[model samples]
Target: MASFKTVMKSGHPPTLFAAFLYFDFCFAIWVLNGAMGPFITETYKLTPAQTGFMISLPILAGAIMRFPLGILAQYIGRKNAAITEMSVIILAMIYGFFFVSSYNDVLAMGVLLGIAGASFGVALSLGSGWFPPEHKGLAMGIAGAGNSGTVLAVLFAPPLAQAYGWQAVYGFAGAVMVIPLIVMIILAKEPPDSEHQSFKEHISCLFTKDGWAFSLIYVITFGGFIGLSNFLPTFFYEQFAVTKVEAGRLTMLAAFMGSGIRIVGGYFADRIGGIAVLSVVLLAAIGSFLALTSTPSLAVTTILFMLCFAALGAGNGALFQLVPLRYPTNTAVSGSMIGEIGALGGAILPNVMGFSKQYTGAFATGFVVYAVFAAVVLGCLFLWQKKWVGAWVGPRGKVIDPTPAQLQAAGRLEPIAA
Candidate 1:
């Protein structure tokens, strides 16, 4: 593994920093409604189910948009793709502030905010492309840590909404987005040799067994991470009877812890192995989810949720670390595919919790289901390691080249050299 200075020398720092800022602000805006969920419910007099859908629309819309944005990043450039996303956010903010009046109006704004959510692939492409292979995990993790922007939303949005109404939150987000937009325009650039690929090339990379496997694994890690991030505010409000601002403050702490730990996760992935890190995190998540099912006190629930999020953050870094190693030549497309599929979990989990609460009068059923799923995913990961240890694992435990036979068995026609 590279030292911090060595890793720093491997990529253009200004661009990487800009990528982090871009992703940070995008994420803050993407889940703004989640932070404002309690307030929105009060204002709109929405049912639990309605509140769930409100938080979900942006997540689902973002998932839907990520694939195309990934493709677009290749065609235009990651920087350009990000610029376009920011432009949409500005427009969306204007609409949200001036035109939105009803629940449906807020729902429509969520769809537009989905463009901000779509920046996941673009930011990853921008930050990871500039870094050396051995350091990509750390690079991507730092960039992905922009997810800590959720802290900004949850910590501040509710207070602002309380002071000025939910519409004010959008205006504030728009203002905050401007700083990153400017920095990105000035500092971010496409890495050299990032030539566009044909649709067929992308398809060949995306439509494979390994591709789907990565997607499923990402769904659990990133999906669970983001799903819980968006829903925690609602969970806190309903389960604890906290005011919106207090709920935001608690969720803010959890989001900050989770997002910051991702960098450590990435660094460890470079040193140990992505699969190794992922194994530990999935196991931790399974335990945490199971704990949640017990419906412990607020303090216990908060601690358990924080522990779960910390593991998810680490798993996210570890998962992307494997991507460049397994599909070096197709990282952009494969990352996009995995990211898009994984992100759909964000939309799905909130609905699960909401419906569970509505019908079961509690959230234990949803927690149990997620825990079972995490355990199943962990089992599959262990089996995968057993199957491809030689080809995919280096003698020193880093990613290495796979043999032709190994490539074929993994559903790839060619092996990407390490």
Candidate 2:
């Protein structure tokens, strides 16, 4: 194992830091509505279903926008793409501050927030691009830990909303956006890892079975993380009758666990293998989900959520550790495609939970359904890895040079070579 200092020496650390800050701030903005959900619901007199839809709009829009931004980043450069997106996000925040007067306008603001959410692929790719393959997991994990921006949103937004009104928080968010934008301009550089590819090659991952397989797993990992992170404040407020600020605080505890553990996940994935780590985390997520169906006490529920989030975060890191191995040249584009699909699953989760509570009188049904879906994906992972192991990766999803026997088994070696 390499020392942290050694790993830092291996990559462009300033660019990595810039990417982390960029992603962190963008993530805080992306889930701003979720952090302020109780206030928004009160202002609009929203039904459970309406609250779900309102919270989900940004996620859906962001997912749809990610791939396009990734393609643009390929042409214009990731650094430039990030700068452009943040510029738009700041303007959108200004719009939210002055113009969002009614439910319809709030919905429009949600779409605007999607612009912030589109930062995922470019941020991870840019941060890890300078590192060698062995260390990419840790690099990506550090960059990916920017999802901790959820903690910032949940921790600060509610109090700010309470003090100055929910809409005014947008202005505050826009003000803070300047900090990251400045850092990105001064510190980040376009990574040298990129290759100029034609449009068809850039889009090729979209057509592969492995790409879709990765998307399905991410649906459980990142999808679950973003979805539940957005919904948790609302869940605590309504389910346990906690105050809105308290709800946000409790959600912070869970989000914090998820964000912090991501780095650990990536580090271990680099050593033991991403597949091994992913398998453990997935089972842990499944167990946590199943346990949540019983509707325990407030403390118990928070702890369960924290455990679930930790598993999801670790799964996220573990999965991405394998992504570069699978799609070395097209990391940004392939990541965006996977992220796009995975985030669509995020859009689905809140609506499911909301409707479950409204029509069926319990959130347990939603938990059960998601757990089942995760189980199925786990089965698929086991099935898919059999082909993956000797083909492109070693056992447990480590990068490897295929042995002659392995190459022959994969039918890649010529007769003489075999």
Candidate 3:
């Protein structure tokens, strides 16, 4: 394994820092509505189902926007696309501060928040693009760890909302957006990894079995991460009768674990294998989900959530370790497509939890359903790895050099194999 300093030397660290900061701020903005869910619910006297839908709208919109932004990044460059998206987010936040007076207006603001969500694929691709194959996982892990932005939203948004009203939180978010925007303009550079290709060539991942497979897995990893992160404050506040601010603080404990563990997951995936790390984390998630269905005491529930989030965060890192291996040339596009589909699962989760509580008087059914879905995806991963192991990747999804026969057959050495 390479030392951290060696890995830093292997890639453009300034751009990596810029990507992490860009993504960190974007992710915070993306979940801003969810962070203020309790306050919004009180302001509007919203029902559980309505609260769920309100939180999910941004995620759904973000998912729909991801692939298009990725495609645009391919043409305009990822750094440029990020700057453009951040500019839009600033405008959206301004609108939220001034115009979001009604529930309907808040819903509209949720859609605007989707602009921030579009940052994910481009951030990961740009950060890792300058790194060699062996170090891409760590590079991406560092960048993706920007999901810690969830911590920023959950920890700070509630108190800000409490002090200045939830609407004022939007103005604060917009003000902070400028910090990342400036850093991006000054420190980031377009990586030299992309190949100029036709639109169809760039989007070819859409037609592949492996692409959809990765998407399904992400539905569990990232989907669950975002869904639960957004909803946990609401859950703690309502379920445990904690004050809204305390709910946010408690939720922060769990989210902080998920965000920090992501880097470790990627580093270990590089040493062990992404497939193996993912398998273990899936089981951890499933078990945690099952335990949570019992709806234990507040302390126990918080601990279970922490464990569940850690698994989801690590799974996120492990899965991306394989993404570049599978689609080396067009990672930005493929990642966007996968992220778009997977985020739909994030949309599904809060709705399911809300409706379950509304209809059944408990959130247990939601946990059970997600646990079953994860188990099925885990099975599919096992089956898929058999074909993936040698066709494009090595044992357990490690990077490997192409065989001489494969090199000759393709008339060039493929980047899929190291």
**Model 2, span 26-125: residue lDDT tens:** 9999999999999999998999999999999999999999999999999999999999999999999999999999999999999999999999999999
Better of 2 and 3 by TM-score: 3
Residues 112-170, candidate 3, lDDT per residue (tens digit)? Answer: 99989988999999999999889999999999999999999999999999999999999
**Model 3 TM-score?**
0.97
Best model per TM-score: 3
Q: Estimate, for each residue in 1-418, the C-alpha lDDT of model 1 and write its tens digit.
A: 4588889898998899999999999999989988899989888998888888999889899888888888887888889888988987988898888888899999999898888888887787688888877888899899999999899989899999999989988888887788998999999988773645567776555656567777778888888888888899999999999888899988987888789888988889888988889889989999999889989998988898889899999988888877766666556667777888898988989888999999999999888888888888888887777744676666323666567665444324453434
RMSD of each: 3.1, 3.9, 3.1
- Those runs of model 2 whose alpha carbons end farther than 4 Å from true positions after fitting are 402-418
TM per candidate: 0.94, 0.96, 0.97
Let me know the TM-score candidate 2 reaches against the reference structure.
0.96
The model with the greater lDDT, 1 or 3, is: 3
Ranking by lDDT: 2, 3, 1
